[model samples]
Target: MKYIKIRIPKATVYFTPVEIEKLLNKNIEITNKLLTQQTEIFKEGLKRGKCFIRSSKQKIREERKI
Candidate 1:
């Protein structure tokens, strides 16, 4: 199996495609659970947020010094 490398704040994680898919699924499940448990807060017109893709890419490049 081919492995891909993922770098986070202070660590690198290696994952095969299958393992990556499983990890994403697990994250979705956990996120769903948290959202359900906090329905009231979410329903109060709170918007979900994400890092800007370009900014995130730049940050990763800076961290990796590549």
Candidate 2:
């Protein structure tokens, strides 16, 4: 038997400002902070994924030249 391990990125959708105000009626300041944090997380994840992909491509090129 063979085993394969895969990593799947997970995501969560946050409430839009209108929805937050209408439904939850949370403070605007807090909601803005939460949204900012979520955006930062997404940006960081993208950076990591791009770096990994670039490194993998480089390794493949290096291997082929050998």
The estimated TM-scores of all candidates read: 0.51, 0.59
Question: After superposition on all CA atoms, what RMSD does each candidate show versus the true structure?
Answer: 20.8, 19.0
List, in order, the clash count of every candidate structure.
Answer: 0, 0
Tens-digit lDDT string for candidate 2 (32-59): 9999999999999999999999999999
lDDT of 1 at 62: 100
| True-vs-predicted CA distance for residue 38, candidate 1, Å | 0.7
Error of 2 at 57 (Å): 0.3
On lDDT, the leading prediction is: 1
Candidate 2: where is the Cα deviation over 4 Å?
Answer: 1-26
Residue 14 Cα positional deviation in candidate 1, in Å, after optimal superposition: 1.5
lDDT for model 1 comes to 0.82
